[model samples]
Target: MAGNTEPLSPRAKLAVTAGKAAAAVSRAAGRGSGSVIGGRVALKLDPDLLGRLAQHLDVILVSATNGKTTTTRLIAEALRAAGPVVSNALGANMPAGITSALAGGSDAKFGVIEVDEKYLAGVARDTTPKAIALLNLSRDQLDRAAETRMMAEHWREGLSGSKAVVIANADDPLVVWAASSSANVVWVAAGQAWKDDAWSCPSCGGVMQRPGDDWFCGQCGFRRPAPSWALNGDYVLDPHGSAWPIHLQLPGRANKANAATSAAVAAVFGVPPQVALERMYQVQAVAGRYDVVTFQNRELRLLLAKNPAGWLETFSLIDPPPTPVILSVNARGADGTDTSWLWDVDYTQLAGHPIFVLGDRKLDLAVRLEVAGLDFRVCETLDEAVQYAPPGRIEVIANYTAFQDLRRRVGN
Candidate 1:
């Protein structure tokens, strides 16, 4: 369902007019991509932009190391049932993106915004949301963001006094520790399949042991909180012990966990489980994730892989062996300047499979693949890469900028 994305009269109309003018200037100036510059300009004009606009409206925030964009999309898909919504549909998590998502429209009853992990506190403090969805935390950009434990600590500080009901992942130790003392938290047993970063306790710096789905810190005695919502296999188990089957167009166990968390968030607004899951089936793609595009005559299933933990999940989505794969990378502002993180990804998953490297960072990616003992050839051009890929749909895994470049080329 398309959102009736007109700006609501919740804020002074002058703020909206000024914000639109900034956006217009940005579009005329041919700034980076689209309206990001415009949004930034608007916020610069009005410091309390989102707070003034989103104070009264129903707002939901989605933040995580991965899946924030996709999960936000899923929640927005269901919240349309409530009323008109304003959301950062372009996967912008910072203030500018949230500003554009909110200031771009008026008369929206609901607002959904995807936030960056580092900026979560500011956004939460600035705007009072109805629900704040905290997904798993892990090591992201080594250059920019804080460590995972530090990220959790910042969250613990930011979320201490919020009135919004917290929907947190019980399986992630970092999330449990971060949301430890929140006044009202609704835990969801959304699966945390990747645990490389969760090896130690965030509180006492002790060993974190995972004993069959539940994690316990041996030293601090912190354990996985009892989840009120769980995804048991193909069924979503309610707090009342009844199970409902939820089918989503998105593939992989990670997406299933995402859907379960999104359903829980939707449930906070009295949205039924059946309705939430059904609407999610319409969102096959989130900002370019899970987007199947015919790029250069080759159908490509695109998934973004920015760091080690995210790479683990993306690798799981690709069909193993004999399925041709395209690996793309770039070191742009959105993507961290440091390409050293490339070594952290478990590229061995593609061992013995036909892999083709593409991107401006193709040479660096090629070196990484070579070190992993994988034999691969380089496809210098997009058409050449598609030709190298096996017939039919090829899995294209890329980082931030490369994926955006590919998406733009595909005319999204």
Candidate 2:
């Protein structure tokens, strides 16, 4: 379903004007980027403001347990080769923030939206997106977010028979199940490193059989679909078996997977795979995920890992042994109230590195580390954590709120 391209209603115009004004006030007040506040105010005046604002543009929505922001950034950058593209580049993945972004980019030709996992269906419905990218789905914010299977079922029901082409990760069983209901899908074999959430089949609720990289449900016979695009080592193979080497400033195999998915989504919008990959290679970081900042006379590479799956990928991005690592964990509202997920992460992987833990939930992390038989020091602040570390480039891995806190402190 394409958005209505007609002129916005009087109410919607008023809402857009009001939202821009509110966002300007928020920026001036130094409260935030004001996307959410502006969007919220606009929606209050006109509930359908998002749909109206998105009417003129072909929108693409990206959602995942991890790498959504990076993939969104990649898609936006790649789509820019086509024309002006508007995106919530600041990691605002909700309705209000999305509305604010669209309100600001009214004249843009395309919209690339980073949608929160829970809100993907709703956002897709509202935006009438041209294409939707479903990256891997894993356990994230367990206390606040829906369980993996439940969320998949929600996506299946909401996106059933949708006109939009879905670019789904064929490697993830949950993502496959979610996009299975869509009439048109471009499957990409994006790697799924974290398999804890996909042990059970979403189809028949039976045990999922994994023979090598292939996944299938023996009882139900639900199997992984052959992908149109496959990530082979350092290259992304196109549908016709053309391999495009992925050279990204971003590290880790996870980012390579994201790039492969981004290329597939970009193809849906008519951007060539080579051109899309070239455009994506320019992106060094996403909303401060891989930013290197100087803090306390030490060079710190900031990495954000929110959940167990995210942490698994982050651990791969860190520097080698003996380079001190700072692990920050917070149980704030944005970080989720439950710190029990910390146990799910393989903290033992940081055995050789000098590990320092800090944040509101540092105690919980420390206990997890202790059980893993890794010695770690608990600090009160990031500065203290840095002070305790040896003199070298430090790798700092933090969860949502804690990462933001450190980012602010480092002025990055």
Q: What is the lDDT of candidate 2?
A: 0.92
Task: Write one digit per residue (lDDT tens) for candidate 2, span 173-280.
Answer: 999999999999999999889999999999999999999999999999999999999999999999999999998999999999999999998888789999999999
The number of clashing residue pairs in model 1 is: 7
Best by TM-score: 2
Number of backbone collisions per candidate: 7, 0
**CA lDDT of each prediction against the hidden true structure:** 0.83, 0.92
Give lDDT tens digits, candidate 1, residues 205-262.
9999888988898887989889999989988887888787879888888888888998
Pairs in steric clash, model 2: none
List ranges where model 1 is wrong by over 4 Å: 1-12, 28-33
Instruction: Tell me which residue pairs clash in candidate 1.
Output: 6-105, 6-106, 7-105, 7-106, 7-107, 8-106, 8-107
Top candidate on lDDT is 2
Candidate 2, residue 66: lDDT: 90
